[model samples]
Target: MTKNFNIWFKNFHAGIVLKVDVLIPTKDPSKIRPRLLQVLKGSDWVGEIIIETSKPLSRARVIGARKCSTEWIAMFDDDVEIPENWFDSILPFIQLKDILAISTPSIDVNNVHMIAYKRVMDHFRPLEQRDAPFIDNTLIKREVLLNYNPSPLFYSEDELLYRYIKKHGKWIHPPSCGVKHFLVMKDLVKAAIIMEQLGFYPLYKFLRSRVAYFTISILAIGYSHTYKTMTFFWKSNIKLMAGFLKARVNKKGII
Candidate 1:
C-alpha cells in the first residue's frame, strides 16, 4: 500500500513545482514526535521541515510559517500524528481554484470541555466550509497566509485566519485529511486559554462568549459519560471561570 501510494502521488504531482513546508511550533520539545518528522522529511512533496519555539503558541506558529520559502505550508502542532498518505489525501483540493487554505476538523477527545466545544461548533459548522481551521494539521498557501497576521494570543488565534479565508476565498476541508489531535481542554489549561482570549473583554462579552458551552447538552455529556466524570467536569469549568476573572483583574494569563 505504501509503495504504490508513493508511486501514484509522484506521478500525480509530476509537473507540480509547489511543495509543502512542515511548520511545527512548540514550547515543549519533548512532545515533538520523531515519526511525524520522519514521514514529512521522507516525502518528496515536502521541502523544509522547520520547528520553532516561542511564547503564546500563535506567535510561534506565525514565525515558523513566515520563515519558510515554500509556496505552500503544512502546519502541525507537536501532538498531531501524520498519516502515511497525508499528502495524497490533500492532493485533489490543491488542484482547486482560489483555495487560500485547507483544514480538517480535529478528531476530538470525548472529554467534557472538548465534547461541549464540538457540540457548539457543530451548531455553526457550515455545509461546505468548516467553522474553524484546525491549525494543528492544515495545508495553506503561504502568500495568502502572510496577509493576515495572528496576534500573540493563546486561543481564538485561528479565528483571525478563518474569518479572512471565509471572506476572501475557499477554506476547503476534506474529511479524509483529519489528523489525530491531543489538546488539554479541561482544568487549568482550559482556564489559562480562556483568560488569554477573554480576560480583557467586558463582563457581558465574556459571559456571552462562554454561555454557549454551559448548555444542558454539555451537562448531559457529563451524565452520559458518568457521574464522577461530571463532577470533575464542573470543577474544571469553575476553575476556568475563576481563572478568567482573576486574569480580568490582572490583565494577563498565568503570570
Candidate 2:
C-alpha cells in the first residue's frame, strides 16, 4: 500500500485542483496499518484509506467506494507505478461531462510480450466483451458506482463495470494516458492461475491461440532452468508454460 502511495504521488500531482482518495482493502489490517501510516504521514492529496479484513477483491472495492468522499475515485493495485505526467495526460478526459469512467493504457516492465499479448487480445474482444482495462488503475465517477453494485462472484469485476457503463453511459480510453506495469515472471504465472480459477479461461485460450505465447513460455522456462538453476524460478516458469499448454488443449472461443 505504501508502494502504491509513493507511485501515485510521484506521477499524479496537478495544479492543486485535483483531490485524491487512496483506498486500500487488505485482509490483514494489523500488518498493513503501520506501513500505511508511515506512508500517509505527509501526503496532501490523499483523503482516506479504508482497510478491510478477509474480503474478496470485488467486495473490497465496494467497501473502498463507500468510504470515498470525493466525486471521483481512482482505483489502483498496490504494485503498479504510474509514469510521470500520467495524470496530466488523462485529466481532460476525467473532466469531461457525461463520462462514467476512463481507462488509461498499461505497459509491462518485464516480459514485453505480455503487453503485446494484452493489446492483441483486447483489440480482438467485442466491445461488449471488453472490460475497462485494470480496475485499480482506472478512474470512475462516484455516481456510476453509487448506481451499480459490483458482484463478488464475477471473475473480472472491472470488465463487468465497464460493460454496465457502456450500456448506461459513456466509457473512454485515451491513447496517451497509461501506466507502466512491473510484472515479475513469477507474478505472471500466478496471475494465469488466478484467472483460470476465476473463470477467465476464455482469455487464456485467446492468448494461446497462436504458437507465440506457447513458444515464449516454454523457451522462457527452459532458459531459466538451464541458466539460473533456481528451482523456484524454474517452477514458476514451468507453471506459466503449463498454463499456455492448458489453453491450447481447451481451445474454446472467448466468452
Candidate 3:
C-alpha cells in the first residue's frame, strides 16, 4: 500500500505540480526527525516537509504553509496518521467548490471520552460555533492564504483562518474526509495552555461544558462497567473549575 501510494504520488497529475507540505514543530526534533524521514522516504507526496524545531506548532504550520510554492497545501500535526485515501476524499471538494480551505474530522486514539465530547458538542452546535469552523488541520489554497495571513496567536490561528476564508472564499467540510489524531493526555494539557495563552476563554468554556455533558451522559446512559465514572467526573470537574477560575482572573486583570 505504501509503495502504491508512493507511485501514485510521484506521477500525480502531470503538467501540474501538486505539492503537499507537512509542517512539524517539536522541542525534541532529534527524537521525531528519524520517524519523519522514514515516512517521507516511503511517500512521494511530500514536497517540502518543514521541521521547525523548538517552535510553537501553530506558528510553524502557518509559516510553512506561507512559504509553500504549491497551489494547494495540507498542514498536519506530528501525531497524526494520514490514510492513503485522504487525498481521494479531499480532492472532490477542491474540484467542486470555490474552496479556499477544507477541513477533515479528527478521531483521537482510543479516547472514548474525547470522541464523546466532540460528538455531543457537534450535535448542539456546528463546527463554526466551536471557535474554528475547521477543527482538524486543513488542506488549503496557497493564494487564499497569501491574501490573508492567519493569526500567529497561539490557539486562535484556526479560528482566524476560518474567518478569513469565510470572508474571501468558501471553506468546505466533507464527511468522508478524516485524520487519526493519536492524542495522549499530555496533548490535552498542552492544548489547554495554548488556549489560555491565546485568550480563548469561550473555547475553554465550551470544552468545560462538553466535559460536564459527557460526565452526565455517561451517568445517564450507564455505559461501561470497568470504567470509573467517578474518577472521570472528578478529574474533568477539577480541570473545568481551574480553567474557569483562570479565565475569570485574566478577565478581571484585563478590565
Worst 10 contiguous positions by lDDT, candidate 1: 1-10
Give the better candidate number (2 or 3) by lDDT: 3
Please estimate how well model 2 matches the true structure, expressed as its whole-model Cα lDDT. 0.56
Arranged by lDDT with the best first, the candidates are 1, 3, 2
Which scores higher on TM-score, 1 or 2? 1
lDDT of 3 at 241: 58
For model 2, where is the 10-residue window of minimal lDDT? Answer: 223-232
| 2 against 3, candidate with superior TM-score | 3
> Which candidate number maximizes TM-score?
1
- Writing each residue's lDDT as its tens digit, candidate 1 over 6-66 gives 5555776676544668888887878886777777878878888888888777677667778
TM-score of each: 0.69, 0.57, 0.68
Arrange candidates, best TM-score first. 1, 3, 2
Off by over 4 Å in 2: 1-16, 26-45, 51-54, 112-132, 176-178, 184-255
lDDT of 1 at 82: 77
Instruction: Find the number of clashing residue pairs for candidate 1.
Output: 0
